[model samples]
Target chain A: MAKKPRKKAPKPTPKETAAKAKKPKHPDMEIPFLKNVLVLIALFFLTYYLVGNVKGYKWLQERFIEGNLNKLEKFADLTTDQKYQAYFRFNHQFLTFIRDNTADTAIIYMPPDSVLDVEDKKSAFYTKKRSNSVQHKTWSTYHIYPRKLVYDREKEEIPSFDQYTHVACVDGWGYEYLEYDVPKQQRARYQVLPRTVKGLKAMNEREKNQAQ
Target chain B: MTLIHLIVLFLCGFGLMNLISPKFGLLEKIGFSFPLAHGLVTLLMLPYDLLGIPITLTSLYIPQLLVIAFVGGWLFYKQQLPQAVRIQDWNKAKSFGFLSINLPWIFLMSILGYLLYVVIAKAMFWPTISFDSVAGYDFVGKMIAIEGKVNGSMFDPDLPFYSIRSGYPLYVPGGFGYAYLMGFDSSKITTVLLILSTVVMYYALLLNYVKHTMAALFTTLFITTTEYIAMSALSLSNVPHTFLAVAAVVTIFIWMDKRDHRYFWLGVIFMALNVWARSDGIVFIAGTGLSLLLFAYQEKKWKELIIFGAVSGAAFMIWQVYLSGTLGITNDGVFVDHLFWDGEKFDRMTDLIWRVITNTQFYGVAMIVIPIGILANFRTIHKQHYHLLIAILVSWLAYTALYYQMDNGGENFGYSLKSMINSSYKRGMFAIIGVLYFYVGISPMTQKLSQLIIEPGNPFKPKQ
Candidate 1:
């Protein structure tokens, strides 16, 4: 067929193959009003999402941690070193957990009974009975207070956010309110943190008065 | 790793990202820097055996990181690219337009941030670090350290803990927390976080500067660089608060310029979130919203006026609803609480703002306001852009007046104003600065600079 007129294909109609590319006509096409409305809607939902799902964001891993105290309870005849090792592990993990969760913004609270040795009458944790209703606990020895966030409007002044905690022990010495910043990460390992009130020997009459 | 080692790694990562990037714009720029920040954060993990490096953690794997980088880079690039490459002339653009404007300060800020990390991180072994850092960010960090998640109430239960007020926000916390999660000590991470944040703001403002987006970014940075902003960031929660506040302002300004109104929505959402970021952000959003409404009305932009009114009104209402419904609290209680125990010391604070306006006894205290006035006066030279300068001046003055009025008849009102200025001076200054920056870009001076300072075919052209 003589190559069908040099194999010239049928031309595509305007609707079939392609139409000429048309100009946008308006330079303000980039400034779409609807896109803004859509963006606004998206922003609204995002704010809602962040604000709404806060509870779900809470990490409940701490409650599930296995304390060495539990292991000691199970194995009553454990060695002192074994018990100490477990206590150390439990405390380390607990501290680590707190640091991880709060971004190093947390509080530390120690019970009145835990301030000093239970057997010694002159222990650092010892507290004098002020009256029937009120008693005095020597709280100055163990200074690692719990960190609480407080609101401060003065930007240059103290932090608005603060840490608040009530430390109570097995003994009936009552609860003590403690507040302090999160401990430094580097020193967290080297420093003993006065695990017991007896560990600190710096408290005096003046300091005792100041604590009250 | 040593600081030098970290620096080397950062350079390597930055180089790798730049090589991988398809082109230069928003994502590419961020791509170049994001890896460095991320790598630094991960490298911090080398000290801790339990935590190990973050890259080793399953949650922070390379693939997931790449995905995050891709998404973050893409979105930021998308938003920034439109503003960056859209410029007509590449030569007319300054050398590293985004880099130059911010690099000067960011480098300085990084050094300062590093020094702060070292001083606080190491010295914390002493008992003195106990009172501030321990009770402040360190305590918050400890909570996260133990919990492996962030919680607001841990910092201070007395404050509004329900919102995002207590801890660092998403990007900020991620930058800092990533270090700890990866096993690096927190002190170093804190330094990295501050540096990264400053850089983020630097680039963010640079992008704004490039497209004639806003003036507040430059002014805000200028104000932040002052002793007041520096002191505040060193002391309290305002560092993150300033960032969040600035973000909200940028969104609002973009909305105003483009009138796409989507930015308004973003602004409102950010404003609402800002309140939760820090107690003062609510005030900033409210003040800026009022300014926006007034400006729109003045400009005869009826549509924008309505949008600003509705969005701003709804934001306040939602916060009120949240306070009332969730805590059964009122603004009066919140204000009273702030007054007594929140460390405002109101009278001294207000004095700072008053002195700046009237040029009172405290000359240096108000020195920061000079650049703003100059920026405003320069804008008046061009009749078309005059109203923007006027609006910024009026809004800033109005805020000062409102602050004064609120403190009126109270003891030491001047002090309260001083306190407000001290805390908010940087951000307030920024809002004006960003607008004025846009003014400068359109002014004759900018054209002269483009001819002299910028190269040929510069992309930064004055908008007609």
Candidate 2:
């Protein structure tokens, strides 16, 4: 009853060996439901704790959650003009005022940046250092589109400088170009006046007359 | 009515996508429709404005409807109408306990939803106020809408008040014009929709290579890039251009990997639109072109290379012809005619680029995460995605080189080269951020990690 010679197991072919390596270890293994749940919970908590400790997280939370969301909610009830005003402030107001006062086809004479940037306590116009929105030609044109703007610097370049239909008076710069005198009380810091030139006075002439 | 208009636009894009290829997934179809439709609309408006056709909502809508009809008729004739998802499949998916099995998805979805809501609300609640938009794109768009012509008052030489940015391509302005023509009070809706389309398409594209969980996770990461998300709410061309560039490169990469002709054609369309979004988008085109050329050489497919180069370069050529040939506008002299080496300029550009790219405050964990992912999978990197790596590197180098060669001495529109680097260049990195995250998402290491978490004991594999 001696055992017959034991048969050696057949060697795995190359294809079988490769397939075995590729196959999942536990093809029928059930998902470890509790383990996955616990791991996920740990991961969520870890991420929460890690992100909470970062300095950037506070800024993000404040900027996006507290600040932007609240601001958006508040803005929900405002009109489009109010919303524009909130962002553009006085720039929008001035431009809209110009739009209302001038015709669509009117050519406006704008003050030079130098004049607009002058610091006058009694007549505070936009300064380039403080704000460029109103000082920016394209920005102003966008606000009052279909109306053209010309500056003193462009006076030499633009032959139609003398033909400007209106003057955007800022810091009383354009008053000298006006034909009639605006009474002291009537003159405001910012005004869009019709460019009447029946008796335009040069600054030098006014200075000579004052000296006399 | 706005909703109806949006629906029409989406359908128009959906029909176009179906006509291009009926093999797209549901999410892919939904994600790509709005942008394709929007891009086509902007392109259509160009010819209309040039040919003296009044750009009314009717004018745009009728052509789109015809597209839909033609797609439907063609598909019906070919008997290749797209198969709808069956109810039984939905039931099977519903019964799979997806919620319990994929908790990461829930977390990622919540984050993405919150960010999207905030961005959309911010965009909708405010009018266009960004300086560039107000002075340039929005201004031109407003003029176009009011005058019903592209060559209207805004382009008058006598006015001379329009910003240099107004001379850039008409995508953003046309978008604004389209919104206005649709009777919307605010053009910000277009911005909002574009953002939505970008996010959706990004996620859908990721799903092709990764599982749902990984796709959601990386897509969340893509949107959360701080400066990018901040700028997303503003009506700028950068964010939208980012979408086109990323779509083009990624689709081309997918085509390389899958050898699918549909992806190839889609990639070509996006690459063309990339330039239409902004002329500088040619950097992306050049980058992807090199990749395609390499693929063609390796596979001996010269015809595909010819097709891609000719089609992608068409938009750039057309835009140039319009600007210089048709309008007789001289070159702005932004770049030097010949390349020169300035150590100071090179160093300054690279230093700033490094600072911007690595600044965690701007890019969150992406700059850190991407490198770590690459290193972890370095052994298999060459085998899987060397083409994509080359594309990213070449495009980035070309972009930086362009800036280096720019004549930064004179200020244009109050923007010096230094200022442009800090702002425009910083914003332009949004495209790179997107493509990098996408690459990392498809990397083998990420796939393995995803499997370990989602289903332990299962072998790691790509979704395909």
Candidate 3:
């Protein structure tokens, strides 16, 4: 049998041609104004999601860290290394403790970490000027004088502390103590900080002399 | 702060750039939009030394005074400021029945802009928290700001730390000091503006090639969400450097693809200036140049090849001359790459690779999508694309290799790995983000995948 006459496709209407011309190559690109709006709305939600992630990051930092960035809680119980990390954040608290409790004549020894590779006290001074920070140090440094002699602790570098009646360790990290040397053989050591003249007779006498 | 000093200075600079190079008609295409304004600002800032005076409050403020006087004179003589500066392209487009990104859309853009402002401002106020910023980058910047010149004490030999940072490129610090001279003494302001300019410039750049949506998406994703850029908000470390790197790559590609001389000169300048942005920027610039040379060779563009090679080679020499001559920073010799065989080199390398590819902070799902997207659209890639791909790979790999040559090996292998993970990984990631976006943009499957997720039931969708 002869092949049936092939049917011709109908020509597209003008409206159809316009629609075809306007059609996007990718479906996602269609209704571009709408797509842009939707993508942006999704972005808003995505930002919130990222913010949540930042919160988790902050939380992780807290769990692994101690001291001020760790909420400045009592870190007397943490290990030395843990306390070292805590000291990295608690320099502010250390300054506060020194200003509040210790004698202005008291000198502090702050041991710098070799890992940080800081050369000397001047290094932190230049680095921390913008923040008005105490020598770019939250770990340990000679930047926390406030009204006391804060020395870089290298044993030989420290001056004789015999002239000062009181010694306070305000690093807020490991080995925290404030002690007043008594006239006699005995020494008065405080188990806790912010300790006033309840037990030490010599400290009370020194305070009275200062006030007078 | 009048804020208008900043306004007038930047506007004058923008006008000046347009006057200098009318091609691309930056102001015409984008108007006073973010990208155009940013490019003009960057051009002014990059060669800011041409101002040829000590950067002091008086010096910077005086220049603004001069520009304002000039603009004021022009306004009186011409009876108008040009429409380009008076209005942004977005404000003058015929989209959605009115000019440019209209209505609630503008409101939406405002919200986004405000959020970025808040972030940038916070970073500005925050103290230099990162080691690199504190020890080297900002330290150099603050000294220059204080002294009103590039002080050589930044190269102090007593401190080993200064030695490490002494070789750091000074253009960024110079930019910061210029802002400081303008009495804005905030590194945050300088760094944030640099970042905003970079983002805007890159966006303007892509608009020259891609569709508007693709360009928009790429800018939004690549610029806004990159973790390192966010991490760098408080410092001028990587973001500033990355700007020049991306500009170098993008401009070269634009030149090769479009055969535009504007792009060629622009890319060459970017390459030369990239060295001034960061020491490692040469890796990106050189990689792009190598790719371009290969491209030129294949296309048999002999004169173009000679010109490109000569310009780039001279630029490198000029950079060295400026460094040793004007800056007085002598290289301490080749870095003892002893850490090449140090602990966990292989392991650290692997971790870095992981961080670059899988880090959700910057690329989001892009890492997963890009490779699969490429595989799905493998046939779509042309010869020209292969050349671009080589450029991208070289830039990314060159840095990864340099990571091995560093002395970052800490106490143990894990410590070494952590060190690599900390900063080096971010640097490498910055190199690839733009390139990966381009690849994904060209990939056919990336579009289909987006359609599948974002618009699942379009009537225009073809049946399987």
Candidate 4:
């Protein structure tokens, strides 16, 4: 008996053929250039808006910082670069210092005005008190986000500043309800800030001049 | 003599009780060890009441030792006790044993080992006060002991602002509340009873899942290895209830399989015990009852279904009555008083799910085995294991949802989520795990392997 012929697969319909043919050579190109540009703009503005306004992201960042600080071990071995980076990163400079120095005694400078906000409310320093335009000022003042450092463990601590009482500033971010070790002896009773790099530079300069 | 001496004396007393226990019938044998341990510990504390020993390490150690001695003796006696019913050594038990019982045992061992290292060597108990235990089991346990009844206050303090109505007693296998009610100091009894109940719970869980005695023992070993389970057992909260929940699930599933109404009653007893172990148990009771009805439906046993329905209904109604009449609580606040309606509650619940999904460690290491098992028998899933797995997953989902939304308007989602699982979701998922294991252990594939080797060529072979 003759073997039954296998049925040939149906040919593609014109619509299917056209659809397949019409597929973009670079598939992503069909996304309009203008739309792409708009998206980029939107994302930029969106990130800016969210970062500036939403309290949730800020809270998460703070928690992330707290978590990171708690995880840090052996601060004495940090690179000078790492020390500066960490110093610039967290709101809790004192904790960063403790983590770095493993200090037997180290001072944390808390401005008398640095009362911790224990209540689950937005820091007054950020909200309510500031004008919309000026809120960014307060936001910039605190290291509001956690920065994951990729520093060698051995190169974490370096004495960069001559004002080395081996102190770390642990910014409570106004949540004093959270606990960390900060000895009374190590605390700076006064917080002096024009809090700018320039201001710090000026203070260093003044100290140098006085020493001279 | 110091408190240590008193504890040593208590240890001797407990050993004595265990020896005498075997003679006085089953209940007496089962229960006798508890009294000597609890009584001695209670007496040791009396000096604090009478002579006022400083409430320090030595003082706490005294009671802790007394309790441990009792449990140790109980364990010793259990080892000596003959296997309850020597089932003819069907190789079926051996084959299914590893997944059901051995895996839990191994898991428990590794966990306990790590925890010991961390706690003893590193002096680390990070994120202490086990999260889930504080909210559901531990706090409520204290309340039960203090008030001598399950009350609004049992769910209060944990979620003071929220008015929830889902309060049930501890649902863990080694039910803390049951032990507490059986006349152990709520605070002092927790460590001892939890450890003891954990062993019993594991054996029971294994019995339902594994067919072979060795396999059951192996599973118990796995449970002991699990750090989370070990940590949980020691805490005042979730571990005990989680164990109980698993025990209840295993017991009922066994009842279904065995068609033994005695197992059914045992299941009910465990379920009722679970109710007092944790607030989430109320929802569990409802879900479990629904699942049992499905089981009855599958078996075409209307009589069993009706009986189960009535018993489940009576159990729930009793708790409801207690809540409404005795405790003066509303439906929303009987068990856990989490803020359910609030947005924050929803967000936190979502966040918790996200965290669990994201965290690799949260799902125990043995999780890898489960997928492999499923993959190996993917074809059988729809025909055999689907319902069981589905029931367990659904129960977990339901319990999580209840806990996620238990607070007041989700206002305190952080608090609510934390309260529900308390520390971790491990304890909350205990019952579901037990259900999953029963399916895993009793899978046709596993059971068939055993039957093939043990009772080969027997005419009355179970059909696949």
Candidate 5:
């Protein structure tokens, strides 16, 4: 009684199954070996990019030179690393100080340096609450604020006594912004504070420490 | 508050995404990608704006957003869910080597790098201080975040020196408003997330067509590492525009492959979003939509083509009407100054833009790679990959023409040209990413690549 012979299944080809895969030839890659090496080299550079160039970790490492910075919670407490960031990381120390501490209401006196860290200036604005009435200057070296005093108005040698609460000075050696903590209504004279600041030694002790 | 803000926004976004994802068949198409996140978050502001939903942190707005979230969530859960599989053996799982070498790895690395940068940038930089951030974009964003809606007082020209662009879109601010509503404080966080969503969504879009290795390489080199992309990814209108552009192209690519209407809907949504982001997005949407129509016509899908064309045209027209009504159609002012281009001015701008292209920064590698990739795979571009190329060319050519024709109406032709180039050339040149993506797709020799990188009897490419 006729059971037709069962059809045999076809064996799968190696191309269709698990086998050694062929190396693709890109038109951009005339030589696969060279392309592989180049790709590896590119990968190395990419790894280097993540590790070296970002500067985020480098700045962080400088912060933690030998088991430290854990206690440096306050910006005032961050003296050692702060100065290091100033001299080393292009005024990031001073910038960080301005950013974390400088309130939007604080009238700050910043030095004239167009080439300063623009990102730093931008960061300082985070401390600010956007005021609709006060139109911000777009590309000022000083942070976005209602009152940005580029220079003291008197034009004297020591500059005139003014109402700036902070003096952001960037001299030949490094940068530091000396903040005067005084009563809100009363303006602090720049000529009467302790010459030495946080034991790091203020850059311009005479001018910076000039408190009255 | 920051954590809570992020969590609430995340939930709202994902819920909208779930609804959107199911509708578009995006999850079904891509097998669980994060394109939905980009789709939802960037898009959350739209319905609010269009439907006159005032953005506030109060129970009123919160409840509205949640209603959407819940409805979406309900639909998502109610759908035909994937059959649950019992974990019997660990032997069937793919190797780490295969997984690590592909597109997801690139996305993982880029996301990690972005998070690291976001942390540092958040620590170091205030986004509001950037020029564009201060001038036109996030200034309003700051307002919306704090005020929970547009502060009409600020926009009052009668005030002293009100400097915000009147015609600028509110998505950026509205995006930030969503954040502040969730109780987040900083605008920088919103900026960071916008940039992050952009890269993630673009990465998902890349995986739609390209081999994983190639997709990873293109993303890292062209989209992720480049400072222009990194910085501009969330800056102002740039990220939104990029997202919509990427989504539109990828959706078309998906539609091309699957011949489905669901992808068409997503593509149309993205195009609508593009027009909503920036005025220039009109050109991009029109170009990509036109390219899609041509593709549909080629495939002889008359119904699909006509439907897509009608929907997109209607969306564009509606937005145009709204913009004209509110913004006012200007003739001899800011709008007219840009619209009219003298031949001499065009020539001068052409020279300037040529110089800009030649002296590319941050994206210099892409500038070189894109041209070479195109030339090397000229055959592939002409024959097999013309649709994507057509999209790129249309967008690039239109944007390029825009840059040339847009004059500040200055007497000195040179300064106007230079200024135009300065403002636009970098952002406009972002259209090159499309050309580069299509090139990588055609160039990678992907079948051979899958075999080399993936394991034998690989689940991703079992037939090699």
Candidate 6:
């Protein structure tokens, strides 16, 4: 009984150990084609949902397709000036009238902001709350360029006030600067009148009479 | 005639790009052509006006042609002309059933195409009707075209009719003036072309980072920036400036990632043009320049840094010189020269920025998606994309600080601090949105996701 003993096993070689160490413990796992497809589908839906939630669909349909594409034909035949007219409406019309009536070299005396701010049915040139578009020197000058505009507020600062050859009469406020009398039928709510010598003379006479 | 002018301009840009570097993708060349050409043409107008030369179509066109011929001849002589369009990747993907397998690309493309069509149609159909355009850029542009000079009668001392915005920069006005000189009935064609070119370049640039589906998805997101797209239809400098500034920042980042000299030079040119587009674009220049300084110092590329600084700052300096030295127009204290601190203004600005950025109506889901992507990849932020993130943060901080230090107390166009924060500051966020989306597209999370969708094997599988 004492002589019965088990034998010890031999150790593996270095090469064998190295080969075993190089071998992978687990095989590579291939993702199923269906799983990949599902992931793709999920991503697509997620993106679509996010985009939709952000109003992309509504914007495409309403702002672009309906708002622009549908009106493309209607706006196609319109000339540049006509398109401006459509957008700016009465403000553009008034500016265009000034541009047409005044000479390129004419120095224009622009009406005060008060004249344009008048909201009464008779005296109001712009009935909308957006007043003083015509009275804005920069905006008016943009429409009628090469023609000088002198504002009442800045007339003293601008030495060209004395060189004004025309007056923009808004709601009959600038008629005092005009040399000629206007008939009631011929008078417009907005008109540009030439400041001739006779008008200056009449203005001087009125000033003299007021002084006396 | 419009088509002809555009073609000539494209060739000019193509040639210029070729001169910069012969190695370029076809899409890159085409996408970059118009912006580069337009920038050069507009820049030349300043010198032309200074020298009393009429800025006629002939003056601009002839110089552009010479440039094209020189570039074309040089490339041909060097045998560096592109032999063929390399679309083999697309064909290979198609052959491997990639498109059929990944069907979302179709949806994304469809959305992008539809949006582009509508946006272009809107821009082309409308005349210049925006208050800013009518009173400022368009007005000055029309006068420039008529008088063949920037210092025309409109700038006469006796007639102070031009708006404050007229003195900002001449790029937008020059674009409109170029269109007018080309015999177009409306100058809105400039805006239409800018939108088209920007979209093309944006999508093309995105492709370098992400797969087709991801690129298209982000591009769609970019185009659908609610306020940006709505404003793109009208002629305003904001959208165009957004394009230039975004292009500059993204290209600079691309250079940093790829280490390509060509991209570095391209980034420089675009950065310069960014300032040329709008002076406020200097904020972007500063942001990108600081990043480049770090890059150059680390890489020992002092020469590249010098070139970038010189070229990028050239336009801003020239513009300042022209305004103060030549035109005799001094700043009427619009910008504060020194930096100062204001706790109330700082708090208010931060609050407005947070409100605007979080508002889905302004930027769509861009604000939402960007933060999520960034936080999801928080572990890799320092190692992977800290440079870009820093640039964006620095640029935004500078922009906010610039607005904060301003003397915005006057009645210049009814712009109050709140309105400025709401409108202009909001619009400037377009550049930030664009860059952040680009960052997300290139982030590790997105790249891994892209791999999972494109590759057939399990991304989670252990390596053998």
Estimate, for each residue in B1-464, the C-alpha lDDT of model 4 and write its tens digit: 33444345345434544443322223222322333333333333323423535423345445556555665656656774332112222233444422133222343344344433332221121211332333344444444443444443323332221123124432331234334444443332444444444454454444444443323423433343333433542444455555556656665666676666655655665565565445557666666667777777888877866765566556556656655565455554323554436676577767766555333344342354455556667788777646456557667777776655444334333344454453446555545555554565567666654443222244255557
> In candidate 5, which residue ranges exceed 4 Å CA deviation?
A1-42, A45-212, B21-54, B59-127, B164-166, B229-234, B300-332, B335-343, B411-415, B442-464
lDDT of 3 at A175: 30
> What is the model-wide C-alpha lDDT for candidate 4?
0.43
lDDT value for model 3: 0.53
Question: Which candidate model has the greater lDDT, 2 or 3?
Answer: 2
How do the residues B351-382 of candidate 1 rate in per-residue lDDT, one tens digit apiece?
A: 55545433322122233344544554565455
Q: Against the true two-chain complex, what DockQ does each candidate achieve?
A: 0.03, 0.19, 0.05, 0.01, 0.06, 0.18
All predictions: root-mean-square deviation over Cα?
18.8, 9.4, 12.2, 22.4, 11.4, 11.4
lDDT of 1 at B219: 33
Off by over 4 Å in 4: A1-212, B1-192, B204-227, B233-236, B331-355, B382-387, B400-426, B444-464
TM-score of each: 0.44, 0.88, 0.64, 0.45, 0.63, 0.87
Q: Give the per-residue lDDT of model 5 (tens digit) for B101-176.
A: 3333444466457544644343233234445654555555555554444533334322211243434555455555
Q: All candidates' lDDT scores?
A: 0.39, 0.79, 0.53, 0.43, 0.49, 0.78
Per-residue lDDT of B284 in model 1: 61
Best to worst by lDDT, what's the order?
Answer: 2, 6, 3, 5, 4, 1
- How many clashes show up per model? 104, 0, 1, 88, 7, 1
Best by lDDT: 2
TM-score of 6: 0.87
DockQ of candidate 4 relative to the true structure: 0.01
- lDDT winner between 3 and 4, please give it: 3
Q: Considering summed lDDT, which 10 consecutive residues are worst modelled in model 4 chain A? A: A145-154
Error of 6 at B345 (Å): 1.7
| Candidate closer to the true structure by DockQ (higher is better), 2 or 6 | 2
| 3 against 4, candidate with superior DockQ | 3
Q: Between the candidate structures 4 and 6, which one is better when assessed by lDDT?
A: 6
For model 1 chain A, give the 10-residue run with minimal summed lDDT. A56-65
lDDT of 3 by residue, A1-212 (tens): 99999999999999999999766554322434665566667756765665457432233223312212233335435543343333344334444545555554344433334312233454322233233233343212222322333323433533352233333422232132334333422332221122224435655576698899
